[model samples]
Target chain A: MSQVSQATVQRVTADLYVEVQQFYARQMPLLEARKLEEFLETLTEDGSIEHRPGGWKLEGRQQLLTEMRARRGDPEQPLVEEISAREARERNVSYYDGLVYRYWFDRMHIEPVDEDTLRVRYQAIVSMTDAAGKVSFEPTTVVDDVLVRIDGELYTRSRIVTHDSPAWADKIHNPS
Target chain B: MSQVSQATVQRVTADLYVEVQQFYARQMPLLEARKLEEFLETLTEDGSIEHRPGGWKLEGRQQLLTEMRARRGDPEQPLVEEISAREARERNVSYYDGLVYRYWFDRMHIEPVDEDTLRVRYQAIVSMTDAAGKVSFEPTTVVDDVLVRIDGELYTRSRIVTHDSPAWADKIHNPS
Candidate 1:
């Protein structure tokens, strides 16, 4: 294994920082547009996901699409995009070029299963705007475990996570 | 559309937690063991990785392998895993079943690009350990734009983010 010089590490780390910022600026809006096919294009062809319990665990683009079919029973309520924040860290770097990283979603925390995988988790307090643009708040949490691979390509094999359940009354009484 | 009950969210989130934890237990060992082929099984067949400048994108499993081959040139330095600390928050909930979440990883963070997608921007401080257990620190940051389709499936479409330049030393040392 090539010893990572202090200079090499700094350069790699800085490059990674800038890469993350660009993703948001260039790709987020398109996702929020619910351009399903377009959004999927952002990932590798074999990309997959697995959350947990009964309704988590999707694999491959085809399977992913099948899962999406189940979630978007109504196209109108398609998953929309909202920008909150993004972060990453190389928790540990071992001798053999292994890098463990963690990623955060609003209230979700994702760690790696290996050098090339992901695991997600979260706990959160949230605020939402209703159709009238009225604001509301709630507290919730989630934990997601995902596996990501970057052999020469980037793709996820597993994505398992947990989330809090919502009540019908909450949605009915306080509709977004 | 099915109204999401608070209970549903909580239950789902919890399951996600357990799944993620399990994944870590299973995956970390495999990686530290350097079971590269086994690790490959955990990724989508057509996965891709966006590593650095000059459009260093790797697509397909074989491509990923090539990339890894180029990096893991050292047999002496084996990979290792470490524990991670993280936090999460729900920023917004849309009437359209959209959720905006913010998750923090050490000093970095990732937020939802939309209900199902994520945007990440981050920098990190890594301590590198050699075969003799010598320790050194390296700072590497990554900005990732990832989108997850949460239809019983979780897959990332794209993760486009900037990273510190490989030639950062020249820039830093020379002050260009």
Candidate 2:
């Protein structure tokens, strides 16, 4: 096995950090607006996205486009993005409430695989609003966006959304 | 067994959320400031923190504290927190990224757990920034915080932070 030196790790880390930051800025808007074509532009045509459930990995741009269209069948909703911490012990765990609101956007999550390729996971919360039309503090809905990166860029490979959480489930306005 | 009503679930969720929020607000400052005595008060006396290394789980709060203290001992290389998320996907299985930012006295991530007991998996790119004279990001020091709810209250029972993803590591760190 080759030894990963401190200098080498440090260099890779810096580049990876830059890549992640750039990815975040690009993906935030399209997710909020539910713009499929615009979102697809971020990916390599031959790239793929994988859904966490059913272990279903969608390959190629065509299947990804199909999934995006299906997602658009439902009306888009508002979501806020933030960062929070969790303390895990043994195996069971719980997350602390309150989060450092980084930059709230219509965005999702992504992970890297190897050097150029990446795995992506996107989510949105579900919540209810009051009669005053103010957004409720509670979460109502959640959407998942997972993708793969090809040639140092990300493309939508797989996606899904669920109503189990109140932020999205109860308030979902199905376009069908 | 009786079905858990949505109202019941909502109430539980809200209460749990509040408790976690309070715990963080109270403890974050002490932990970040490295106020050991004050920080220790937040734990349940016998409380412990864990990190993943190879095929085993590290145990004990004292051990964790000792490790943290030693890491902090590096004066030339001060340790700080920096968590950033990239993407996420959720369904029966959830995936996530780009939902965390940590800075010594402050930390945040979108934590998702199962509805039954509220055991959540931490899926975020957690970066630590080392601040000596000025604040800078630490690329090599990354971590994940796992959590669980107990007795109708939420608390971080465990943490599984490792250099690589866990065995069940999927997508994580989306706000769902």
Candidate 3:
């Protein structure tokens, strides 16, 4: 790679950081809402994700959609079901009734790979919030992404997520 | 307060977001190194921190320096002590030796308080890494900061830290 001026690199990073944050801010909500098609739009058609520690790779947007659908289930379907009286009494209904999952990305570090592409690395922490207002955490992961500029907009070209614990791979790949 | 235009708000937020991130990026390292005086320099002379849930507050640079010194101990003092043979055998030496604390701030939301000030709110997660490479987390907190620009540089004027758990206030107030 040719050496770029330090001044130019700083300028690029500052501008790119804002754009990347905005892109993810818009995109992650779609995923949270299970708007799979809209979330897929944030990535290139040929984009891919590689989950480390398990060596699982989802190639192309179709595979991405498939994996996400499998994990999130069909949003169009009804989520809740009628429960038996005994089951309802046995379990803490409030805790399981309105569970929410949240993903937080932080400590972003950006590097310019070239004029059009950038490498961004960040730590992601996941949490589950129950209706009772209790929160539990999942193992943190480090995500490295390759983002490319397309028509002045940023899109993920590829992503590699490496979990802090190997046990997390089973949970992520299989869900519960 | 006069109503600012939406376009102007967007522009200001974009610019100020970069500035705040850069400011923290520089300031946090000084804090991690226990450079209390330098860290205080990043804040206004009369800056204050309010810890919610317990109503603990530290006002002014002098108080900040005192509180920080009390928590971090004197950095000039040597940290390690020669352990007795029995102590080394009974306790995990690697876990206590060379321990490091890290703070991560993310998901920032910026609101323009005025032409000269911005209210930025973000989540902060604290973690400790032991020499054995084990990592543990402290309670996550939401921090609201009022930042002001003085001659094109940003400085924190006030901060409010609200921990997710009330028990964490004890840890912050009296570190063990």
Candidate 4:
């Protein structure tokens, strides 16, 4: 084991901070635009997203992509890019028609694991806007994510999310 | 800022891991014993404890100590230390009577901030045993804490505790 000098800690923290912030800023727009394919490309093949409060942990890229599509899919319509405008209008009754998702991340601390791997603790909020532009923000989740640089691109290896209030995750599934 | 050598990162991780584990082992016993003064002494003057599932963040040592005493106080009587054995039995109407708290820390990861401070991510479970020896474990909390070494003694600067399940923290406040 080698002792980390003060200089080394500062250097690692600053670099990792930049890497993670840039990744989030870019990927969040793709997520908001519902460009799942492009967003998925940014993730590693073994990446996973976990909602810790709900005990929802899906591992592996293929499993995540499949589950994500289903979760974000509109049951009444075909995929967004594949459907025509008339077909999209037909699905308005489902309330998912022309749906929008907005997500933002606040700066957080970065801790290095290795030259290629680090962990970031960040606070983020996601808002859901219906076809009518009725936007609602769910409770915030402080996301602790393990990020790695592969082929000079940053990817989230694992994400563990925590809610601010107790029972918030339960409320998400079973509305009051 | 200087880049950390692979050896430095490994050394810091190993040393901090051992230091934190030893600290918890000793302090948990003091906590189980309900030795508030000694427990308080182990915390930094500006120590804060945030229970995340509720967004309950209290800062400063005095405020924390006061609230902790109230929350964990023996409702049937004063503190356990000041009460007599017969008096303790007389106030044994609630299960808090003869309540014994046993805590177990499963694992911890150390992330260095500087030579003096670092954050430790730890998973811990606490079980409460009544006078009848019936023990039950509440849901676990993964605690993210900042530890600082002051005067050669490790002190908890801040603790952000997030439970494994959504409703666990609420359960503590309102029992079923």
DockQ computed for model 1 against the true two-chain complex using alpha carbons:
0.02
Which candidate achieves the best DockQ against the true structure? 3
- The parts of candidate 2 lying over 4 Å away from their true place are A1-62, A65-176, B1-12, B53-57, B74-118, B124-155, B163-176
Task: Indicate whether candidate 3 or candidate 4 has the larger DockQ.
Answer: 3
**Tens-digit lDDT string for candidate 2 (B110-143):** 2344652333222223322333223222211124
Model 1 agreement with the true structure over B91-156: per-residue lDDT tens digits: 211111111111222222344445655444443222334545444332233546353545444443
- Which runs of model 4 end up more than 4 angstroms from their true locations? A1-11, A74-98, A164-176, B1-176
Reproduced native contacts, each prediction: 0.00, 0.00, 0.10, 0.00
lDDT of 3 at A165: 81
How does residue A87 of candidate 2 score in lDDT? 13
TM per candidate: 0.31, 0.33, 0.54, 0.45
What Cα-based lDDT does every candidate model obtain? 0.36, 0.38, 0.65, 0.59
Question: Per-residue lDDT tens digits of candidate 2, residues A1-176?
Answer: 34544434444443353344335444543543456676666656665654332234667767778755643332222222222111121122221111111123233344455565444434443222211112223232244544555543445544444434433322223111
Q: Could you tell me the fnat of model 1? A: 0.00
Per-residue error for A54 in candidate 3, Å, reads 12
Given the true complex, what DockQ would model 4 score? Answer: 0.03
Shift of residue A137 alpha carbon in model 3, Å: 4.2
The C-alpha stretches of model 1 lying farther than 4 A from their native spots are A1-176, B1-14, B17-33, B74-126, B143-161, B164-176
| Ranking 1 against 4 by DockQ, winner | 4
